[model samples]
Target: MDIVVFFVASGCAIASAIAVVAQKNPFVSALALLANLASLAALMLLLEAQFVAAAQIIVYAGAVMVMFLFVIAYVGPRGEIGGGVRKPWLVALSVFAALLIAVEVIVVVFGASLGAVASVDTDYGSPAAIGKALVTDYLLAFEVVSVILFMAAVAGVVFGTGGRPVRLSTEQVLAKEGESAVARRREASRAALDAARDSTTGESAR
Candidate 1:
């Protein structure tokens, strides 16, 4: 049953991965990626890495996929690729990349003599152990990743606004509306006063 489950997850993972690349619609492709992540998490669970599986589901499938979907929605159809004319250089580059991946897969499967999988302890994927490793051994790498993520967020904001700082705030918008209303009221009063003055002069002349 475990073997069957593993195979099923593996197949789903592969199929969803292909669909992620194949789908022209950005939203559909994001859904495919979510499925792929879900299947990968299943595979991780089968390997007895419960914490890793949970993290995979929560982090990649939950947070990352949600972010991707939000971006796709925010960007709308304009963010979709493959809708415009394909460039020759892009096509060539894609073909070359596919061929390179195929070669690497063939070499790994047929040429390389991979060793047996190593065994791990029961707590290998536990949160405590992982946290300890992160703070102790991988502390520098973890901090670096945080900094990179922060920079990425800053860059995203910069590019999202077309390199311009945010100019309008809630207070600014309200102030502008108030000024417009005041100006409109002043104009109305002036018009009313002019009409009253003209009527009084016409009566006096008569």
Candidate 2:
């Protein structure tokens, strides 16, 4: 039963990973990533790392994926490229990747040693143990990750602005609208004057 569940989760993870890369739509890719994360969580659960599995689901599949979807929504999904294969380099890269995968498979099948599974303590992957390690041994790494996340949020906001002002005052918006209206009216009057002049010239010629 464990073997069956592991295979199923592994297959789902592989499929979802492929879908995440193959799909051109960012939104669909994000959904595939969520599926992949969920599959990974299942694998973690099978390993008896319940805390890790729950964190994977809550932090990655839930919170991170929600943020990804929101960003995709805000940026708007991009249309697929409308041309034939443009990059000749990608063909070579794909071939190289295929060969690498083949080598890995061969190594796993014959070159790998069959070793006994290692044993772990009952609390090895528990939340308590992880929390203790985080606060004691890995506190610097934890704080660093937090700072990196804060920086990433700041960077996202900056890039999303796309050189535009983040906020506009009501008066500024009204002024810009008024200027646009004036420009449109001016353009219309100029077009009308040109049409009238052309008609007058035609009449004189006749």
Candidate 3:
């Protein structure tokens, strides 16, 4: 049963990871990443790391993915790129990546014996022990992560608005609305001119 579940999770994870890269749009890539994270959580469950699995789902699949989706929503969809398979830079990058992969595979094939290096304690992967380690030993790292997240949020707000000022007052908001109204009026005038020209042409023909 565990084997089956592991295989399923692994397959899903692999497929979703591929989808994350193969997707051209940021929103679709984020969805793929969410699926990959969920499958990884399932894999952690199969490994009997219940706490890790729970954290993976709650922290990564839930919180992190929510952030990803928020950013994607704010950015909107990516514009389409026009280029044939003849993109030189992409071809070069692919060849370089393939060569790197081949070298890594060669090294792994000729690597030392894969033996158990050390025995893990019974409760090594338990939630309680990990929590203790995080608070005691890894407190600095935890705080650093928090600070980084705060900075990212600040940066997102700055960049997401494209440096536009937030129109909090009614006058400013109305001015922006007026600009849009002017654009709409211009479009309407152009459309009306085209319709009148067509009518005049038809009348003359008749």
Candidate 4:
């Protein structure tokens, strides 16, 4: 039963991931990514990592996927050929590296068991233990992650907003306005000088 569940979850994850890459529409790709996250969360559950599974669902499937969807929607609908194959070699290299890493992880963790390994107690997804580790040993890292998340939120707001001049200091705004006025005056002066030169040339010719 565990094997069946694992295979099913793995297949779902792979299928959804492929769909994410294969879909032409940005919205459809985002939805496929959401499906992939949900499938991965279910895979974590099957491994008895309840806390990790919940985190996957809450943090990734819920929050991150929603953000991705929001970005797609805010960016407006793209044409079919929005993103082109500009860097095929780079993409190929990245895919190769990812596959190499996946193979290395499989060999290191489950080479003996033919990729099947039983979950241990120490590896159990206990929320209390996770909390203790996060707050005690990894407190700085946790705080850094929180800061990164905050920055991401701020960036989203900044990028998604329409173009507008942000509020500046009074002195800065005044300086900019004065500079514009000066530029206009200079342009008018140049135009008047050119007209005067043309008129003088015509009178001399006459």
Candidate 5:
């Protein structure tokens, strides 16, 4: 059963990851990534790491993927197929390096005697234990992440409002005023010409 679960989870993860890269549409790619993340969470659950699996689903597959979708919706759909692929060599090198790392991880896992590893106690799931660890070990890092999230939210609001500039430089202000004055003068000249033409037509008729 364990072997079957592992194989099924692994296949799902790999298939979804491939779909994410292969899909041309950004929304499809995002959905594929979400599937990959969910499959990963399942794999973690199979490994008996329930806490980590829940965190993965909630934080990454839920929140982060939703955020990505929101951004995609805000940006609207792509109109053009992107330019030709560039730097194929760099991409190949990256894939090669990732394969090498995967090989190393597999070798280390299988080569090491599984019996030598200490058994993990499942007591780490307690709320008190988690709170203590977060407060004692990761408090500063957690606070920093919160601060960053707050800053990002504030920046999104400020930049997303889509308004005209509140402050203009002297040259910009002068240029705008000059353009307005020129437009007004042109309108006045056009009005005067129309009035003169009308008067001339009336005199000729008389």
Candidate 6:
């Protein structure tokens, strides 16, 4: 049953991940990413890393996906973006370089004859156990991550406000009104002069 579940979840995750890249619409891609994350969480649950699974679902699939949806809606998929390194060859080269680095890292970490990874405790995946390690062993990294996330949230808020119409100050409003009034007065004066000239010409002709 566990094997069956793992295979199913793994397949779903892989499929969703591919769909995330395949979908042209960013919102649809985000939805695919959400599915991928959920499947990964399910796989984590099967591995007995319950806390990690919960965090994946709550933090990534829930919070991050919601933020992605909001940003996608705000920016809109149809918005035109100009000026970038848009060449297909450049993008393909970048992707290839990234894949190569990833492969190297994976090989170094997993293919090593003598692994440097310490074996975790049986209760490592438990909330209490993970929390203790987070506060004690990985405290600095955890705090740094928290700070980064806070900054990202602030950036998101700023970006969200970018599309909104800014309110004009009272002084700016007054200035605009003054300018329009002056233009209107100039227009009236021009019309009066034209009308008077026509009347004088008519009298002179008589």
Say which candidate scores most in lDDT: 1
Candidate 3, 1-206: lDDT as tens digits: 88899888999999999898777777788899989989998888766678898898898878888987886776564432521365789889998999899899989977957786566667867899889988999999999999998999999788776967764564565576776766686799999999999999999999
Task: Tell me the TM-score of model 3.
Answer: 0.66
Ranking by lDDT: 1, 2, 6, 4, 5, 3
Inter-residue clash pairs, candidate 6? none
Superposition TM-score, candidate 1 onto the true structure:
0.69
lDDT of 4 by residue, 1-206 (tens): 98898898899899989998878888888888888888888888877778888998898877888887887776676545576665889989999999999999988876565554665786577898778899999999999999998998899789767697787665675587876776686799999999999999999999
Per-residue lDDT of candidate 2, residues 155-184 (tens digit): 988977687757756567668787677668
Cα error, residue 43 of model 4, in Å, equals 1.4
Error of 5 at 191 (Å): 20
Q: Identify the runs in model 4 with alpha carbons over 4 angstroms from their true place.
A: 86-123, 165-206
Q: How many backbone clashes does candidate 5 have?
A: 0
Worst ten-residue run, lDDT, model 3? Answer: 77-86
Q: Compute the lDDT for candidate 4.
A: 0.84
lDDT (Cα atoms) of all candidates against the true structure: 0.88, 0.88, 0.83, 0.84, 0.83, 0.86
TM-scores for every candidate against the unseen true structure: 0.69, 0.72, 0.66, 0.64, 0.66, 0.67
What does candidate 1's lDDT look like per residue over 1-206, in tens digits?
Answer: 99999999999999999998778798999999988999999999887878889999998987888998999998898877555656899989998999999999998898877778789988887888888999999999999999999999999888787956667764676687776776686799999999999999999999
- Steric overlap count per candidate: 0, 0, 0, 0, 0, 0
**lDDT tens string, model 5, 90-156?**
8899999999999999999999887854566776544566668889999999899899999999998
Residue 68 deviation, candidate 4, in Å? Answer: 1.6
- Model 3: per-residue Cα lDDT at residue 190: 100
Count clashing pairs, candidate 3.
0
Q: After superposition, how far is residue 37 of candidate 4 from its true place, in Å?
A: 0.9
Instruction: Please identify model 5 stretches exceeding 4 Å from their true place.
Output: 87-91, 113-117, 126-128, 158-206
What does candidate 6's lDDT look like per residue over 124-176, in tens digits?
A: 79999899999999999999999998998899789766876787765676687
For model 4, state the Cα shift of residue 127 in Å: 2.0
